[model samples]
Target: MSSGGSTALKLNNILIFGLKLLVSAGSLYIVFSKNDMHQVGVTLTRIGPAAFLTASAMYIVSLLGATFRWKLLLPERFTLRRLFSLYMIGSFFSSFLPGVIGGDAVKAYYLNKDAKKLSLTLASIFMDRYLGYVALIGLGMLAFPFSLGLISGSPYKWAMPAIFGSFVIGSFLFFGLRLGKRFRVVSEFYEYFALLKDRKDVIVKAVLISVFIQIMSFGAVSLLAFAMGEHIPVKMVFLFLPIVSTITTLPISISGIGVRESVFVLLFGLIGVTSEAATALSLAWFFSSFVGSLPGLAFYIRHANKPEVKNS
Candidate 1:
């Protein structure tokens, strides 16, 4: 019976994978069907030696941010070089997974081997993920109006309010739970607040790292725009890219191939750039990932001999 159940589960996953592939392919077809491949080539051709350097800079900056953020999460004994290696491999590892794994499992595994505390490891991992969301929220809401002026048609018109509401509701829950714990009104909520109280700086560092990560991604798009000869404001591009990035990270498409291009096309076109240009820009953005992954590949090659992390 167990064998039968396992087989059935495998079949279900296979079916789901098939459907996701179809949807991703169909979306890619739709996006490409509307534009000229020749023009995309032209756009790529226009990117010269300087663009490569710009892309390298963007990738390096993002890599540094990830390294720094991960380092902050570790206990003091861990060296920067060790954290850097793990950070690079873990990030590259996420790209290989079906969804954005984002290094939590791999990272936690190594940290646990050293610290051996389930709570500390888990707390830091959750805190790391939480900080990123908080930062993303800060970037969107705090600078919404100024950023909106960058593009002509914001495809994500609901983006600011949606993220804003999430932050507000989240903040309320956080404060409400803590209040309940401190006053002994609802001692049941104490565990959650206790976690926070024990680790005061995790949340702050996470928020800061999240902001840094968002900025790196936002900066990439602006550089792409610059490479493509677009003169849009950095603030506007920063806002729209994050919203678009959230859409791309949805895991429905392969590396967000079609969806991101579609969003860029619609949003940029509304701002008077031709669909061809928008398509070109989006394609450039997609290929840039391959460039960014080069260092990650090198890091993995050097570190594969390490033992697998025991799960907490």
Candidate 2:
């Protein structure tokens, strides 16, 4: 495209983006008006500083694990500084956009250009996520059996199918490396799995770290609930939060706001928790996550003087 055409497109995008921002601001206002902010504030008052501190610690732990994980995925020749910066930016970006695009794209772009093994880096990042989700399922299973008394009576009784399916999928990924002839379905799967088999020493370590990240995050949420003085057991989050997190990870609702709020209320409602309380907790979790990314805005500000690889 010509320079003039590129400039025109850029201007058009800016206008569209500004319009979307206005729409989002308006929507948030509407949602806020309809919401019971008084109850939300009351609930917030119930939560103590210790809980906030724990959540902050949890954020640090998660961010550290992600940075370390990305380091492992970096090409042998890649710079650690670049990988770490990307990880920080990625964590910050994930807080904004729905799903994982913001951070995932940031990491993919940087790793592709710098790592020199773009495909492997991509596969590693994805597999890292796959393991993280599977670990969450594992964590949830550990939590659910004891909380069966809380969950068995709810609509979440459908969890059997979900758990069974996650197991089957995880098993397939673990053992599917041996398949050769049926490579067309997903060649990357074969290669990545094969790499894992060949590098069990490294792969196992990465998976463990991913699991730890999930545990810390789950603990963080439960800590907030506890600090809020809710009668709900910590064991309850272990049981249902993984499922909720997994649901929110789905691409349906924006940033998983509606889906997460609905799940928090629905799942915890089994224990007689109020929908308002659920909404408050969910918002708190999101607020912490968004606040945690303030450092990313710092990074962007520092780098503003340099030419940006604008996402467009």
Candidate 3:
């Protein structure tokens, strides 16, 4: 709240933004140096409009699943329809804004407006995100065997160990929450975990919904791959998408601009996919996701004039 704190925050943001831009540009440069721009452009041009539309539709359904998962975590004060709109607004910020944090901030703003218990509401949001990620890794592990053959000779093949390592670490931390009761931060997180554990049925339903959301995301990307004349296997998609999603979450790029393309080019190359086609697929996924998030902008604008109430 102090001027010095504000200045420090601004400097930190500027530094982060600069780093992201540099990383995005650097990754793109590396990818482009080894691939043909003209061919990639050609591949983009050949994609069917129908396929793109269908992918976008699938993305919309995935958004709904995401909303449902979050709703399961909330109390009776929030409705699914209302939460879905908020989620879209969050998505809009995520797509147009810089990083993952902004979107969640937006969601928090809307939820906190009507929430009588802001801490619980915030905890629900955190759990919703955590469960979704858990579902992604769990599904990725399920698809790992199929993906193993796909990753056999890629330069980034070590990504396998790295991914599993993260999962293992995450598991350890979740269980270790009990050991941090004296720490304020970990105590709050542990309380949220306890809240979820009390409702085993809700946890099950939320995880299942999260899995469906992942499937829908995979379906959207797989459709684009098919449209580009590259019939990507379902299991293969399960493997690479989680990795791509995980990498993009690093906040080292602007919405993963160049990072996604580079990962696609690297991994798809092993499966005989041309760099051009792979880039096209990545672009298609981005467009569908961005389009899906556009309504969030409208929602945000409409909500802008609404009066805000202080959290209770």
Candidate 4:
């Protein structure tokens, strides 16, 4: 890369990072302005250290589940421990740096540096993320009818539209990609798609692992809610969190900062939960995720000065 090009890329990243922070701060302000600050404070205080630790433990479990899923898609050359280290490094970048410059890119960067089959490594990472998303949407659809029974006349009456909208959009995208294989313009995408398509066993295994990843994720969140003294129904959490996960992934906010809390507040409101509790749950969940990623920083720094050589 030329010096000027490098500088331009750095500047672009900085600008996008700043914009993400601004969006997060602005959304947080709006959410906080409408809520009772006093109650939010009280709710935080009421959450004991024990509950926080419990949530952190669950977060660790979730990370392991994710690592397992990612490993399922990679070559045999990559060991479980090595993949876990790579995942941790990615998580470190993802948590500390939000927006376009995230852990996914970091994971791809390091892995590609050493990858003989760069395309396959990259495709593995993409499929890892894609399967997780598919599982999320599948869970949402599974929970939709049940959610309707639980969400009558609530502030979140509009959730029905959002849920159904996501389903329709996902279906369109799925079929669109399937049909897109015929076009030369998107041949690269189809190349990877075709590679994975022939591996039915790998796809099935990864999809199953993806389902476990979501279960662990929802478990972590449920533990956080439990810590906040709110017993949100497990079924309700399943129904709504997929929608929340999908929105927060949109990159409109920094690490989903304000968007996550706002969604929690809205969804929890349906069951008469206080905004304070909802906000606390969001923060707790964030903290657990942050803590879970801390080990990645050490791993990243340890590898910072290493020479980039392809693994044989």
List clashing residue pairs in candidate 4: none
Best by TM-score: 3
TM-score rank, highest first? Answer: 3, 4, 1, 2
lDDT of each: 0.67, 0.69, 0.82, 0.78
The lowest-lDDT stretch of 10 consecutive residues in candidate 4 is: 181-190
What does candidate 4 score on TM? 0.86
lDDT of 2 at 266: 73
Itemize residue pairs with steric clashes in candidate 2: none
TM-score comparison, 2 vs 3, better candidate:
3
lDDT tens readout by residue for model 1, 1-312? 699999999898777667766767787788789888787778767767677567656766776776677567655456667667666666666556534344667766666676676556665666556667667767877667775555436556667668668667877786654554554434433454465657768657756777888887777767777877776566666566666677776767665667888878876665677777778777776566556655776877776666644332
List, residue by residue over 1-312, the lDDT tens digit for candidate 4: 999999999998889888888988998998899888888877776668777777676666667777888877765467666678788888888888766568988888888776755566777887788888778767767777677777876656566457667767875785455656566534555576766678899888877877887887788888777766788888888888887887798877788989999998888788878887888788778888888888998888877877665544
Candidate 3 clashes between residue pairs 3 or more apart in a chain or in different chains: none
Q: Give the per-residue lDDT digits (tens) of candidate 3, residues 94-157.
A: 8887663588888888887787556666778888888898888788888876677667766565
**Residue runs of model 2 more than 4 Å from their true location after superposition:** 1-35, 48-50, 75-81, 97-101, 164-167, 170-189, 301-312
Pairwise lDDT winner, candidates 3 and 4: 3
Cα RMSD to native, each candidate? Answer: 4.9, 5.7, 2.5, 3.1
Tell how far residue 4 is off in model 3, in angstroms.
2.5
Give the candidates in order of lDDT, highest first: 3, 4, 2, 1
